[model samples]
Target: MTHIVLVIDDDEERARTAAEQVTDLDWDTDALDVTVLHVFTDNVEGATISQFGPAREARDVLEAAGVDVTLAETSGDPADKIVTYAADEDADVICLSGRKRSPAGKAVFGSVSQSVMLNSDRPVLFCPPE
Candidate 1:
């Protein structure tokens, strides 16, 4: 069965690099399809522009690497969208970059990585930023 790898990231550069890393691992493209889903939270008006650039860059990176990928841009809370997209796609594995948040930040706002780990049924790969 083909493995569908879903990469959930908010940072465009990191997301693209992560996808490239996966491809560099020599995973068979024919057997593994990598999908890069860039989650953006744009509750206020005219907020999408900030998020759109990165997503597009990430998509470009994946395409340049010759990996079969689908780029999706959705507006909402990041963690919620990531979970929903993974479940909806029935992904075989979900890949994400782990960020080190300050204690105050964590207390005020929960981590997306933590949420995905808790909610996703499929394997979740947390790639620390390099």
Candidate 2:
């Protein structure tokens, strides 16, 4: 059976890195599928997935690795959308690229990663930006 890895990230270079790292770790798997998910909150600038370059790059990376890759996007609360999609898909693993934020910033802007970690019952892999 193929394992499904759901990767949630914003359009950042670090997001690509997280996807790359996850793919590298599972390079030897007999079958693997990766779904790159970009959740666009009200704060996001674009409505289309094409606007998310890094997420597309991450999808390309997985595709080049012979892994089945799917790119998807949805507009809503980032954390809520991510967790809901993961659960709905019955994803084997969920990967997130984390960013550093001050307490004040987190309070004002909210942290999607934190919310996902706290709410998701599935295994969540937090990848810190290098």
Clashes of each: 0, 0
Q: How far does residue 29 in candidate 2 sit from its true spot (Å)?
A: 4.1
Worst 10 residues of 1 by lDDT: 42-51
Q: Candidate 1, residues 1-130: lDDT per residue as tens digits?
A: 3444445555666766666566666666667666667655644545453356555665566667666766665667777787788788888878877667898897788888888888878788777766
Clashes of 2: 0
Per-model lDDT? 0.68, 0.76
- In candidate 1, how many Å is residue 48 off? 7.3
Name the runs in model 2 displaced over 4 angstroms. 2-5, 27-29, 43-47
Residue 57 shift from truth in candidate 2, angstroms? 0.7
Question: In model 2, which residue pairs have backbone atoms overlapping below 3 Å?
Answer: none
Per-residue alpha-carbon lDDT of candidate 2 for residues 1-130, written as tens digits (9 for 90 to 100): 4545555565568867887788768455447777788877664455576667777788777777787887788878888888899899889778888778999999998998889889998888888777
